[model samples]
Target: MEKLLQTVRITINDKLYVKDPESSDLGKRIIRESIKMIYEIGFESFTFKKLGTRIGSNESSIYRYFENKHKLLLYLASWYWGWLEYQLVFATNSIPDARLKLQSAIEIMTQPTEIDTAFTHIDEVMLNKIVINEYSKSYLTKEVDQENKEGYFVIYKRLVNRMSTMIKEVKPSYPYPSSLASCLLEGALHQYFLMDHFNSLTDCSIKNTPTAYFKHLVFNALND
Candidate 1:
């Protein structure tokens, strides 16, 4: 029989939640089920009341972990970017070539996700779907400026900074490392989103074995 995976704690910005969900079984359930529900029914239709029903917990319990559904969304997105950063570091750790490191990062960013066993309660692959489709909603709101001031986006910025550094290493004089890196992150997401919703907006076939169009776009920009 396969051994049960050990629980893994994923830390996010404390500012995103009223309580630490990974600290208890109930909290973990809240995060795990919330991701699944958000992916099932987009954020607009997701509610703590519904999540409460699915998890067999009361809505107040869910609220204790997160102030509202919006905060929960931010928490989920932060965890994903942090997780992606971890993937990028692990994939590029042994690579010495700057270009190869950047390429690895791009591949991880665009590739379809598989469940990460570390966080057993959360379905990372489905969480990734939520990230791709609902990520923009995390920050595009009236309170974005306040959230930004509170470092709500640090994890995302750090991931972008990591890639920006790699791009700079490849072309030291490149004046747009950050811009190029952010474009690769946001552009790939938008492409995937388009492929899922408005098929006409993007020609990228995410189902294809090799997710290379993103690499093609980024490498060309860097090569120019």
Candidate 2:
């Protein structure tokens, strides 16, 4: 509960929601229960009616916070990325060795996540599951470009930018820092997902864990 011990509010784009879920009890409940319900039954099978029933609120109450279930999902996914960026910065900011910093960033991004207690309204563990399974759908849509233009992907991009900067510091001559950063992020998520549904597509065994493998790949590529 270290996170809940202090008040930490991770902000998302105001345009992403009809109301800010952090501002009031009902709004927070909408965020909290929606994450649980969505993670339980997949986003496609989730809706305001079910969410309302779970939390004793109505669809209109839920709509007051989010335009629809998709927006709610975006809010959850965006909050996770934002939280991850904070963790990456906090973990790497003090490491004087650029290589060590990069390794720590890899661990933060790739290794399985534990629930963070700072934001009591959020179950970081379940949210991580949702992200691992459904995050790409948030942007793999026809409106991706429009959402990007509207700043919906700012947190995720900022995360990539931060990690890319770390990569550059480790290898100023490296040409594909951004590409590598994104691959590291998306690649790790893919491995996590595939480990569940298509085990052959990934090798996350303890012998060559995903975090360790990414570290090896990154360091070998940079060769710094």
Candidate 3:
């Protein structure tokens, strides 16, 4: 898997950035630092100016890569989803059983993230935290319709569709495969958030993970 990942490059939407951050050293630094900064201070308080000061570069340099903080957040979110899609494809492609393949995909989506050494410039762990905590800010906006038209969310939608297809494979007669696919993806994030901030509201935790909960939920629904 590591060898396969070494040959992979995560593609992001061109409309999401003025310049590709993976193209240059400074660009890579911007991504590496932005993930940490956003993870530390929360998106509401993060800015390119602060990121510039942290990375010892001019704030204008960041604008050359991204139009604004919102676009930067979108880029990060897009990249994370693309990276995850690669993992999902590689991990489950060889499984012969439809049920086992879908089970592996669920584990990839809901399991706690660990650092992926394949991309040295990007921290998968911190990026996962940003996705969980600040991802909604990227699309929960007035311009979402316009951005959707512009294809800013193509990668994320594709990831969901991949899972939706697997669900259909497991249960050909299932009518709500797409809806259930989206629920598992988004619900994993929500369950993690609730586990951290509102423990009493959720049954998921360190011992009882979202992965276990979703696996039970999905298999039961499909079998029923």
Error of 2 at 140 (Å): 1.2
Can you rank all candidates by TM-score, best first? 3, 2, 1
Clashing pairs in 1: none
**Candidate order, lDDT descending:** 3, 2, 1
User: TM-score of each candidate?
Assistant: 0.93, 0.95, 0.98
List, residue by residue over 1-224, the lDDT tens digit for candidate 2. 46444765677999989888888999988888888988899989998999899999778988888887777778888999999988887778899999889889999999888878677788998999999999988999999999899999999999999999999999999999999999999998888888878988777765678998898889999995
The most accurate candidate by TM-score is: 3
Better of 2 and 3 by TM-score: 3
- Predicted structure with the largest lDDT when compared to the true one: 3
- Candidate 1 vs candidate 3: the lDDT winner is 3
Q: After superposition, how far is residue 6 of candidate 2 from its true place, in Å?
A: 1.5
lDDT of each: 0.85, 0.88, 0.95
What are the per-residue Cα lDDT tens digits for candidate 3 across 1-224?
Answer: 67877778999999888999989999999999999999999999999999999999999999999999999999999999999998899899999999999999999999999988899998999999999999999999999999999999999999999999999999999999999999999999999999889999999989999999999999999999
- For model 2 the local lDDT of residue 224 reads 54
